[model samples]
Target: MRCFEHPSQKRLLRFISPIACLISFMVTDLVTAEEAWLTRSQQLLNTLQGQAKPAWLENNPHQLEARQQVLELFNTSKPLTDLKFGTEQSPMGKNGQPLKMLFISFSLGETTLKGIFEEASGRDDVLLVFRGPKPSQKLPALMGDLKRLLKGIDPVPNIVIDPTRFQRWSVASVPDIVVEQDRKSRLHVRGVSSLSWLDEQIKAGKQGDLGTLGDVGEIAEIDLLEEIKRRMAAIDWKQKQQQAIARFWAQQKFEDLPTAQADRDRSVDLTITAPRDLSAPNGQRIIRAGQTVNPLDKMPFGLCLMVFDATVPAQVELIQHHSCQDKKARVLYLASSMPRQDGWDSLKRLETTLQAPVYLLTPDVRIRFQLQHVPAIVEQVGKHLVVHERKVRASQGAPS
Candidate 1:
């Protein structure tokens, strides 16, 4: 708005001012749009992404997106295959023509989802996208499907995209198939369709070819304990011991079951130590000690005695027959690796008051002999030794 002395100056200012204002406005709008897109994409990304989970997810990752994906997978009406999907920004494979991947995105009630996954599991080439709210009980089911998908694509690349974290398509119907050729662009197809029918559409160019799709197949249940033992047979005793401990929780039935807050608060701080595998072969195959083997050659009895019971009675019987030289009633208990002397004193006081014979063993002796825990006290009770309790302190006993 400077007073132009010359006519040329005045003419130049009139043309330049409007152009500058227009450029500034456009720049501002462009920035706003980019910010909004970034925010949205980030939220979507959180839902679909999980880096390699540790051997456990005992503490639920509080990320909202992760929780939603888990819930969605749980409730789908068709068996949901978690597609190893990605956009150009994030893809399943590098360098090859991306697999023609199809994912269906829909929001159905819990009943609908449970029905869908049960139905859709057998289909080929169709994966389901699950989006829901909060903590989910469907993690095990989703993990089961993931395991199956992983098996078909063996030797998985180190950096494959986690389908659990991304939003690729938007569908307008219940039980729909969301298809994507490029991560950036997606389509929703309405209907209840079989896996074969869906695959046919992908071939027909009804869906874009994204180059990498997860296998739509049933996941096999892995006996992790057996797998670990097989892998450890050639390794050293130390490794075998370590592997046993490492794989113990995974072998347990209660590993990932959800708990109410009150239930979680009341959970015992009990530690499970890896016990020795001492099943000896009978004729063709090795038989577990103490009990007859099953038709599948599984050690049902040995597992009960060794794993569940911790060999207390068996050990006491062995001691009585070999070391005790008399029939006696005895109780045995083992303490934790890290001792709580206060617990020992309590137990000792109980023994004094109750008039019970008790004993203790150091961790070195326990490990050398491949025992579960320490401060083990065994009593002869009519030719049997039962592990009364583990990691119990003398102090933990009722005042005798």
Candidate 2:
């Protein structure tokens, strides 16, 4: 080297010194950082392991006894303490007078019951009474029989079942009638009688003796002309109702959309569609083509869309209880169709209790999720919607 070093060797020596230094420094830094991370991780793991576990309740004889006691209490019958009888205000008759009471029994022959109901039919003032035990299980069958007897009546008579009232008035026979003057004065018939014979008796009692009898009026006869007019009015009212429903369905934009399924994660971009305003600002929307979207951007908040049939109440209740776990997601309840008035009323009560928003299932929503059966849950994951057909087990307290 003293004789004269080569220029290439000198250049190589200068470059190699810095490169080696850089390599050594990088290796040392990596080793130090890795050691520090390992130490911190070990400390965290030890801390977690040292923490005390939560105390959990274990099954015991005392718990079992308490549960059995609770079940026994629930199984006991609760007597009606504040029961009142005959407090219902009678509806007004066509003559603007309060209707009279006609008490009868199911034990009466079918022909006799039909005859009495036919006479009492179409009279708003005539309240029909059927004597029976408190209707706990046999109410539906009794109502079915009554409806069959009053088949063609324009306005079916208001029938009440009151075993207590029957006992109070000393009604001991199958076919009986009770004529009342105001709420105080009452006349009780204890044997089978025709409507005409009852009318005659009521007239005789009104005229002959206010001492023995009271100011009871005769039962009004059914006016055929008035009945025809009422039938026409009912038809007109039904037509109006149907038209209103038609108008409601026509205004819905997504009524005819075909149902589709989204059982997996995927993007659903609209290639030739226009943007529209959504109900919620944070809600998912149809992504338009040519719109730039960041793949790494965080997804919008998910929704728990529960589709259910109003008919399956137990299953719906189970779903409602279970779906509360997803606290971050909003719940939207949708019924399969417009149910009967009673079912709709029940849904309204449930909506109030749950404090959740509910809607009717439109074709658009049903088709979008391709929902076959309900109750079902629809939720969003990444860019796609996941439709889950939740099966309710009989063991889960859902009705089989």
Candidate 3:
């Protein structure tokens, strides 16, 4: 029995109650700390995985930063600063994290495979491991097959295509099962078996072969790792990169903005009425429907938005005269429009000249600030947003 709950400690219970409360508080704080650390760790891991996934998939020229992140995510990586993955690197976690792994190879004709997939569906502790993709089928085909198998199944089976696990646990055949818990291998059934049966055997202190799968359909003829390497080697990365850049330009939405005929300044009332009642955590009505809320009343306007047409040379010169200097305020440059033929060069030049990043003005931002003319500066003053439209003449500033 626990010492605090023991008959011998009954008399001392009163004395230790306060101490127990303190210990409970400590445990609560520790759990909170652990959760915070876990969140941080997950964020870092996701960043590492995210960078690698996109750059690798998009066929970009090279992702040095993504490679570096991958290196940081792993322990015992060589040359600390090197971005490229080394050939002769010793990885950390060679034994693998303790897990219930179900080994399977992708095939067009594995009938029992569908059943196994369904049985393992939505299970957190169990994972379906594939040796590699099917020889005749591409990666997309494997995904499609899985899609068909787990159709309408919520929280589908977790899967991975890594031969390293097969090598580690000596998983020679498909549909085999292994149970690992508490950082140790408990049971490994190298043959056809169900997760439930394998679990039962492991619990009952039983060990032996559960028979093997018959000569079913075509097993994955290709090694997934080798196929991946081959595909990467065959790709025309230069053409892929050119296509990416072309797509970027095609997606640009640079709208036309009429030049300002006359200089004028206007204030836009940012007050908005709530559509419904907004309540506090205690169910108290903080704001009723149709009540106005001025954001400026609660928070200071801290950003100076500068909007101009990048296509117009004179307007560009007009923006240069104004450094957008505001005390303790951030400056944001939004381009009204850019020539599609030379948008990249124009954006780069604007950024270089202003020593700041320039963003394309979206319809939402234009509508949000109620912008009607080019070469305008939007600033927050008091409870209102002031849009200062600078009139550009045919010579002094920019032409219409």
> Which structure among the candidates has the greatest lDDT?
3
Deviation in Å, model 1, residue 331 alpha carbon: 64
lDDT of 2 at 193: 40
Best of the candidates, TM-score = 3
Q: Using lDDT as the measure, what is the rank order of every candidate, best first? A: 3, 2, 1
Poorly placed runs, candidate 3 (over 4 Å): 1-220, 236-242, 276-289, 323-329, 397-400
TM-score of 2: 0.28
Model 2, span 1-400: residue lDDT tens: 0112323224323433322233233223222332343343233334423343211111233334445533432321111111121123334533534346666665555686787767765555566665532224244455566667766654454566554445555554545566655543345654534656666767776422223222222222222223334444454333443343344335434222222222333233311222332222345443444444432132332346666665566556756665533567666666664344443345456667556545556553455456666666666655555666656565556322
Q: Would you list the C-alpha lDDT of every candidate in the order shown?
A: 0.31, 0.46, 0.59
- Pitting candidate 1 against candidate 2, the one with the higher TM-score is 2
Which stretches in model 1 have alpha-carbon errors above 4 Å? Answer: 1-125, 132-168, 171-173, 182-187, 207-400
lDDT of 3 at 237: 56
Query: How displaced is residue 253 in candidate 2, in Å?
Result: 14
TM-scores of the models, in the order given: 0.21, 0.28, 0.49
Better of 2 and 3 by TM-score: 3
